[model samples]
Target chain A: MLARDDQPTPPLKRTPLHALHVARGGKMVPFAGYDMPVQFATGVLKEHLHTRAAAGLFDVSHMGQIVLRPKSGTLADAAGALERLVPQDILALAPHRQRYAQFTNDQGGILDDLMVSNFADHLFLVVNAACKAEDEAHLRAALSDTCEIEVLADRALLALQGPQAEAVLSRFCAEAASLRFMDSKPLPVMGLDCFVSRSGYTGEDGFEISVPASAAEQLATALLDQAEVLPIGLGARDSLRLEAGLCLYGHDIDTSTTPVEASLAWSIQKSRRHGGARPGGFAGAEVILDQLDHGAPRSRVGLKPEGRAPVREGAQLYAEADAADPIGQVSSGGFGPSVGGPVAMGYLPAAIAARGGVVFAEVRGQRLPMKIGSPTFVSPSYQR
Target chain B: MTTLFTPDHEWIRVEGDIATIGVTDYAQSQLGDVVFVELPKIGRQLKKAEAAAVVESVKAASDVYAPITGEVLEVNETLQTDPAQVNTDAGGAAWFFKLKIADKAELEGLMDEAAYAAHTA
Candidate 1:
């Protein structure tokens, strides 16, 4: 007997609110092994604008959520185990405060950037939906012998982002109003148990709530019922994050890019730089340390393409004179409705990045002039 | 005043020897957003089903093929600044280009509105 190849098997995973999404006419696409919405019936632009004016609900349950329970000893001792591998001031983290950092290879390149929030109970880890599998494998293989890592499989994550995000969220959790940026606390959302974090990918005031998988749909429905909330899909998410000057994992930053060269030096702590707790002994530490001493080649910068012609991903960036020779390429580029023009971000030589002004991007044999500048095209409205 | 529809959802509005071409409402809705559309240069010759234009959205890129052989007369300049017109009114306002029809016999191969709607459905 042989397996029938006539019908395509359904995708590997499903979100808690999968049925609700199907009911609302979501164009379900297989993304990162989960059946997720690429766009809703209203379309991308409308979804993007809705997130700006009111609260937008995002089903980010596909992202890997983990709980790290430290062995009883000291906070610094437990944080030191992780600090040896990734660069960040995790030990100094106050209970319930969150920190965004990356797991670095020895060469100082980021393996994966993730949100590590220290609650009174455990270290809550939120990793990229695409890189979740690799991240879990690496952590288990790397730290299994030393620390205990528990994969939070039964947990689901949701991001409520926009100007009116706090207003809607405050209705459920009154304690949420005083929570500063990068803060996480276990709060009751509409009588349901969850952890509400005052942070999100979009450059807006928002909360990321992690609830039990069984209760995910009820919570999503409760939030969606408010006139301020609408279901946002991956299309609006990509544009929103891009406009915020935030880096997307696979496209913008990869294992080849060091934190220093990628303009991510802000994530590297001063203590780590001067060898405070545990001298750097991870892979490629020497190269990373050396680069810290001097400067690294190729800095990440934003490009503003003149006119409406979008400079898409993988389009070559070059000096205007010698258009054939490439300087770098666009990692992510698209129309930014808030900026009222096309926006892009990519890597370029440090010299060009330092004296930022204008450069030409080669797209299908035409030289499209682009202005090199800061990543944040629109001012971030995060609740800090 | 003669307009014909292709099975692929392209519309050709024939006026004398020249015919204005664009995608139908069904095609635009299926394609989602219209971010980029590449049009052929004037005086360029094209064959039926040959690459006529390219429309790109956030997720996918599609080629707008010629329904019949013709010479490029004029391309839609409005799409350069406002390609979203295709999403708004794919048939009425977002016409891609006008092509000088090479053979009148090819018009018989196209489907009328009733036939096109049935074919698409």
Candidate 2:
């Protein structure tokens, strides 16, 4: 159970931009052991729409940042070592390119999803904040023999995302505009050295800059000083990523979900697929590959509620006419300001995962009608 | 007519036996970006401190509690088309419903304007 306001609160960690958030009218909340801003004065609705229209500056420093290097100081084959833990083709990942991957357990269930960027010499990794400790331990157990899992505690991460993102970031680093989607480059941003990646959680053309913790505030202030940029909080970040059809670590995916069932087969490259050259060497590859060949029992699908009431997380889903046995449940649901409707994502039986299929979400003892659709409520505008 | 508030942040403006109920401005500000509201049905009995209504914001869903025992008389229909009314004018036109106050003694127990202001403070 979470501690109440008057309760002797556990010490919450603060990010480098914590003070900046408070100065900008951020509503601070305890999130994943960090005192993070859930929203600012603009609120979630406006902040989300603003990010889609212009650019939004997000302080994502709560996410764990780590670098994997050979203990001998020479660049080890970090990708090869990492491939044993995840079912992605890390070895094929070109230098300066980033790939989305997941750490699967023996049963093919996801432990955590992460971003792996090949930095030419070492691998730069980003994992979810809540899962960082376990992820770090897992990495150490899996790859510590070959590479040192160095947690970069001194760096802060910032994401500048939207259509106008390039225009805003170009003021500091002109070379950032040249990077393609999922490309990374080490450059000087506003006099601060940073490793900037042309990617973000929001499915928009943007950049994620990793800066030294001491210089993070200056970089954030400079970016927010731009006309097109506004400081977005975690609330808008959740809604934006939800509308983009991305899975939140603990909510949409967890230890019980596999890549195939989570609708992330695209992340498993062809080289790792069954009958391919590499076939499968990663954890839970047998179950994952089998699910890939023969479909999984359930599939993740998007739901558009019939009425205005949002079908929130944990709301059970049943067939429109039947209420005895629920067919699925809403893993994530909220108002999609851009779509101008209530959008939700959830897992459903493969037979009923048909597009435009009708279902009912049992919310507060009421059966609310909903229609199943593709996971993406809004089409992604990535620069790729 | 006098305005009374519940500890849970709902406000009731009472005129004789009829009372208008809505979440306070502080509550709206805390909720942020009201998107959808599920109003109580007319004639539905609401016990004090019960979940009388559901307000869905951009972030999550919140329950608006009843300050006194009453039967729902009228619901603000404007919220069906535009729920942001709560965020725009929370204590005024965005009132959720009208209730026939069940007991005058229950109203006496609620916090007055000065008490509410300090309670929220």
> Model 2, range A1-384, lDDT digits (tens) per residue?
011267677899999999999999999999999999999988899999999999999999999999998665555367778889999998888889999999999999999999999888889999999999999999999999889789999999999999999989989998988899999867889878899999999878899999999999999999999989999999999989989999999999998999999999989999999877788899999999999999989988888998988888999999875669998899999999898879899999888895457999998888999899887988888887
- Cα lDDT of all candidates, in order? 0.83, 0.90
Candidate 1 per-residue C-alpha lDDT over A153-212 given as tens digits, one digit per residue, 9 for 90 to 100: 888899999999899988888988888888998888887889999999888889999999
By summed lDDT, which 10 consecutive residues of candidate 2 chain A come out lowest?
Answer: A1-10
User: Best by DockQ, which number?
Assistant: 2
RMSD of each: 3.6, 2.0
Candidate 1 residues B6-116, lDDT tens each?
A: 877899898899999999898888877777777888999999988788776654557788989999999999997788898999988899999999998999999998998
Q: After superposition, how far is residue A90 of candidate 2 from its true place, in Å?
A: 0.7
Interface RMSD of candidate 2?
4.6
**Pairs of colliding residues, candidate 1:** A106-A283, A106-A284, A107-A284
Instruction: Specify the highest-lDDT model's number.
Output: 2
